[model samples]
Target: MKNKILIWGGSLLAFLLVVIVVLFIFRSRVLQYTIERVITKVENKYPADLNIGNAEFVDWNSVVLNDISFVPHGLDTLFTTDSVYATVSFRSIFKGRIVFKRLEVSDGYLTARKNGDVNNFDFLFKKSETAQPVDTTKGRNYGTLLNRVIETAFDNVPDQVDFKNLNASYKSPNRMIDVRMPFLRIDDGYVESQVSILADSIQNNLRVRGTIDPGDYNINASLYAFDEKGIRLPYVKKKFEGEVAFDTLHLSLTNKRYRNEKLTVRGRAMVNNLILNHAKLNDEDILVKESAIDYVVTLGQNLFEVDSATEVRVNSAKANIYAAYQNKPSKIYDLGVKTEWMPANDFFGSLPAGLFENLDGIKASGELKYKMKFHVNMDSLDYLVFNSDLDASKDFKIQQWGNTNLQKINGSFVHTVYEYGKPVRTFTVGPSNAFYAPINQISRHLRNAILTAEDAGYYSHKGFHEEAFRQAIIKNLEEGEFARGGSTISMQLVKNVFLSRKKTVARKVEEAIIVWMIENLDLVSKNRMFEVYLNIIEWGPDVYGAKDASRFYFGKEPSELNLNEAIFLTSIIPSPKRYRSSFDSYGNLRSHKGYYYRLIGGIMRRRGLITQEEFENLYPNVKLYGRARDLIVTAPDAAEEDTTEFELETIDLLDF
Candidate 1:
């Protein structure tokens, strides 16, 4: 029995050794056949030519490939490599998977260029061309989708990489970017890459290094300028029309967890010496010294949330932020931010330079804190909730003003009235300026009329009304357009007196900040702000202020307007340039304006701004006696004039 066992074992060993020897002798041919099969399959699907000059197995686990290239049909070369050497796992091949343990490339070039709308990379996304549009109404699990993508990406990346003399480029329209990488490597999950970039003829270099994890969500990376000029982004300027630069940017993803159909991700991102320049953001370049955010996000079945534990820091100020959006059943949103009470000096110093241009260099005393919350249900627009409050301690005070002096509205100053975003007139708000109307000199009917129509709570509230802003948001959402503004009497005053009239996000922000300062700090009194607002705003094409508007329409002074005349003047505030739409060929007010008169007059009467007899006697038979009378257009037919009235009623009556 012993002899039989020994003979059988020797026979099995001899057979296995012979099989190994045969495979080694034909390894090059086997590798070549495998490469050919892969090339044929890829070419069949992509409509491209894939070629390899030579392929062979240098060792049991290593493959050497030379002169590899790929090109789409009738297009420039997409990729080319002089040589590639990869160490692959042989056992994974038996399981129908090719895993590369190490990969090295020599002299590689990849190009992605776009001319107009046509691009060479479209072929790589060929499958997407034939794909159907997504049905957004359908239910989806956000966690499941994101997890699958992360798993697929992490599973495929090689553990080690060594690439030298690699070049890549992209061009679109008049813009182009060229990247030259001298060295790129990954070893034991550590990555290092130094790349020189030329974008739109501007040159820069960048350095990147990080500790990465493939099987887990663990990464810490730092990216910054290779030289002393800081890191300027390559593709952002053209894409966003904004120049962005930073000294250093770091990101760390420390943890990921899943439970109860929710995937939680914890991470932190940091930046130093960040600069942003854009028209919509600000007219000047905004600079921040340091900023960071430690965030925890929960991606759920159909919702995404950044938990309240998330902390954000900018310079010396810090805040806790929470935001969420739910798409299931109906779209709902929520956002909140709460900040710690910090020194007012630090708060003012932390303001971004260009974003808060009016507040820059402002000096203050005491402590300040801020809190805000917003909630909305798209399906129920009326139920939207919002509140924002920025409070200072009792000892808080502004010691010095910044670039803009908030107290200027209290007295005479150069007020520029803009027409179509160009300065049509620059004059003083006091008696020295032509057609300037003081609060007391303006007609009581006109004052009451403008205030009641533009902002009913202009006297009782601060510079901003939370309810008004909330309703503004709801109204805009219902109309699916920006058709309303929540500007108060004070906001309107600040916008006209201290800020440019250009419609931009940055201007709006500056206007808001200035309004708060003047109104809350009593830098400008309510009556004075209202006086300046009435004097500087445009009431018609080239007709500005209450004094000019009255003269232009009725050939009368500011104090001579009656109730009907004031109401008529107020109604045109929405489309002042199109004010002729409300008049007939004879310069008589449109008939539908009677409804507007009754609506505004009744409100004034109820609020005790006018008597009941004044409200009851109100009429829309306003007549023009000035140059505006000759500007009215002749009606094609008197019987069809009601169509014009109907069309005119579609506009929302406003004064600011």
Candidate 2:
């Protein structure tokens, strides 16, 4: 019995040893085959690279694979990873399934770059021939191995991917990067974004939040657009920067059969502190220095259809804009835009012959609203209507206003026009008799008195006039109103040339600074400055400038005015409408003749421009051409002389 048992035990041991050796010999080949199957499955479903070193089954239930790695080409450079590592379980080896318990990756880097219309990773999958062929002769069913491997590999991945200490960077040419947020992720068609990116060149900050589906070609991102650039285009330069955040971004390609199939996307986003600098679009480059601007904006969009509602938002430190349906070539659709305060002077402040040349400085702020309807096929616009109101205030010392030195003026104009590619018609109306000269001609005796207080050396002095300003300030304090302005003639000219009608301490300071700059300019430029100021100064009513007002009111040129007419024109300079009121009523001027006499006396005492004799002759009988009418009455003749008939009768009797 002992001998028989030994033989049986020995035989069992031999059988077990054979089984163990066979398993050990096939382990490495089996492991290698399993990895290759996984690679083949990945290649079929998506584009990827999978490579493996020798793999070995360490024990019956565990596998160790060396140098197992994947490199997916065509992914954005922002999502590049150096290598991946994981330990997989072999318990399901007989069942033809892979179960990975742990996965880890290292040396991952991300970056984004914008170059015109092309973005990175757009060229991926261009070379499909580079893909490797799958080996189908492995373990498990030969025909089903590829599909199962693919299913297993994709199934084990988490819906949300986690990365450890990721870093990202981005760049664009010619634009200062205002804000940048590098770390980002997407899972289940939703993107997890934590980035703050800005660019000074574009003058805006984007707070991006949303989901992006790379496979379906849909993206949902939000942006905040602001315009603090403070300048106009062609020569303006400004910078800005800020942060942005987003929520619930979603996008998908809709296959609905209704109206052309489209890609729809939606999301919400917010932005803060966007910086802008040196923002300009030029038909021809205008050489100028640039400034920096900062501001913020927030907006949201829902159910955006790419085919129906293609929209683009451009925000930079200098400007903000939103445009939609811009790609349609045959029709003009819905479009909207909003722009912040920008001044012509601020934009062209440094240009030699541009908008800044002849002005003191500019104080400009307003809104422009318009609707444009057109036919894209004909490249023709139908009707563009807009409403804009602007007020320009000018003050001049040495500048002429109908033969009088213009002190200051507040002028406003409202314009509305309809255009079919070109202006069809326009209508404008404003304060009648607002012109200075007509009123001045009626109050001529007061001309010398007003001129005595004006600065004769205004053209030679810089912006500051210590004596004049001090006297004007004292006069203003005494009057309880802005009765006097202290600006120099050059300063006044500057203010009138470029600025708006806003009266403020800051505007005054800016005017002073710009006028000071004018003194250092050349003689020709100084004269040109004077010319621009004279031409733009508001005289009265709808009238502007000496030449225009002289022609309209007196039927004479500015140089043709006599002392009486010139002084009268000057008298109305302060308040043309008041003079017009006086002219309209005879009693008003008759009662005020004493005041006019006193004004003449003051003009004489001040070394008045006209002689004392000339002043006396003109003061009392200032002939206003159309005041009253002269009438002559005539009676019908009753009796007529009869000398011819009596002489004829006496002569006839003598002749017979």
Candidate 3:
């Protein structure tokens, strides 16, 4: 009885051993057949040709595949190659969970071509108007179908997987060249990276560390993407570090009912020692140290939105620039911007030529603030508008004689107020000399007269005054002539600061907007506003600002003009060209218009700005001296026109 039982047990053990040997012996064929079956299913759905070589199965626990290649069925080009080896561990074989291990790829290549709007991978998957229903039926028959579907889905996925070592190259023709790193792993719907890339002729080296959730279609990479362009997108390269770091990049794709929605890019960049040549008023090179930039952008449904900020710190200077944008077909909205310049003089001197040439060597150290809001509409040329404000400091000075010299200049004005579609007004208050007379006494007198007539309240208003503008407008309309402008001193200052001398409603509107902006800004003080106005305001032909005017006319300090001299200077404000010239020693008009004196006297009296006695004292016939011929009365010539014949012709025509 014992021998019989032993024999039965031995037989059973032998049978089990034989079964294991047979399974091992045919393992390679079994794996090959299984892989071929999966490939066939994938081909049916996506039309792809797959090549498999030297597949082996191990103890019914795992399978190894070597030398695999895949190509689109209709396309003759190979898309990928897998060499060395791979093992599919059968830990969850019944459930079709493929855990790959020890994969190696060699001399693999991927090529993609895109032209116009056609992408090479557009046909990678089976075309379907709607997603197919999932098969939930059980039993071997239904199980086969489900397994085939899952295998087909995995085969159609776009991936380059390799372990151990991999050498891969990609050519896109229309896209950029790419060379990828070795060692790839995929498990549990997760693709973890141990990868690097050499792109653009291998001139750029990119290091990438990230994770991709294939099931969720999301990717995040911490990248160091750079080239030798000396120009970088989003961030600039700086010294100490030759490359900029685009840190913590993230991207995600989500499929909705109608479209595949994409959310792209969340990251920041760090660049050290960014150098900008000739960026300041004096054409000096600037170095931004440890500059950092942060940004986020999203694109979907043909719309793109971006928000970014930059912080730069240089030698004794620091600046912060913030910007945001929403791109749309009808309009571009400039959400907002705020730029703060600390120790502004350091950068001010580096501005380009023709921008602030006369301001060179000015030791102006103060905060400069700028704020603007506006929109541009592509549908209509007239649909444009913006409002801006600029403010600075009055304590700024000109560097001369190796020392910082303060002009005792304290003043302020509104820089801009209207743009696009808004009504605007502006005002200013500064030293009389800064605005009207920076040159010599004669030039100062001429400047004063011109400014007073064109924009009064130049020395009193705080950058804007609606009431004054209203009164001036009404007065001009009542006179049936556009002889007077209602702009304040700040408005005129703004015009001088940003534009040339062109008399037009558009120019006026722009000027008013700028002035209003300056008035509302906190970066610039009232006094600083005044200083800039004085430095830029035109005094006369070839004369600008109080300093130049003072040098040209009185040959004295801007502060030296007496009250009578000031009044005389102010009187010529309306027509400097008619009044600016040497006259006879005698009070009689010489080389100038007698009408100018009468006109000034009349205006002063009508405005209640002068006494009757003072008006009478300025009459043309106050005194007489010098040779009669040399002192012969010469009517003031028009500054803009010169022609004795034209005058005679006019007289003749009038007589006729």
TM-score of each: 0.76, 0.34, 0.49
Please, what are the lDDT tens digits per residue for candidate 3 over residues 1-656? Answer: 99999999999999978966765565555565667677887667665677776666544564555667666755545465555445565443433344454454555666665556544454653334466643333212322333334334544444435444444544455345455555555544445444445453334444455555545444444444444433332212222222333222333323211123434444445555454432211133334444444455444433455543444333344444434343343444444555664555655543322333233354544556556555544444244444555566665433341121122223333333333324243334334334443233333433454444555555565576655554554555457677666666666655655543545443554455345434543334554555565555444454455555455544455566433344444444445444334344323334344454555545655555656665555543322112321333344542222222111011111221
When summed lDDT is taken over every stretch of 10 residues in candidate 2, the lowest stretch is: 642-651
Put down candidate 1 lDDT per residue, 6-89, tens digits, no spaces: 999999999878866766676556666667778987887687899899876777879888999998888778889999998877
Candidate 1's TM-score: 0.76
Query: Largest TM-score belongs to which candidate?
Result: 1
Instruction: List the candidate numbers ranked by lDDT, top first.
Output: 1, 3, 2
Model 2 lDDT per residue over 504-558, tens place: 4435644654554346323235344444444444445545566554654455655
Error of 1 at 170 (Å): 9.1
CA lDDT, every prediction?
0.80, 0.40, 0.46
Clashes per candidate, residues 3 or more apart or on different chains:
0, 47, 65
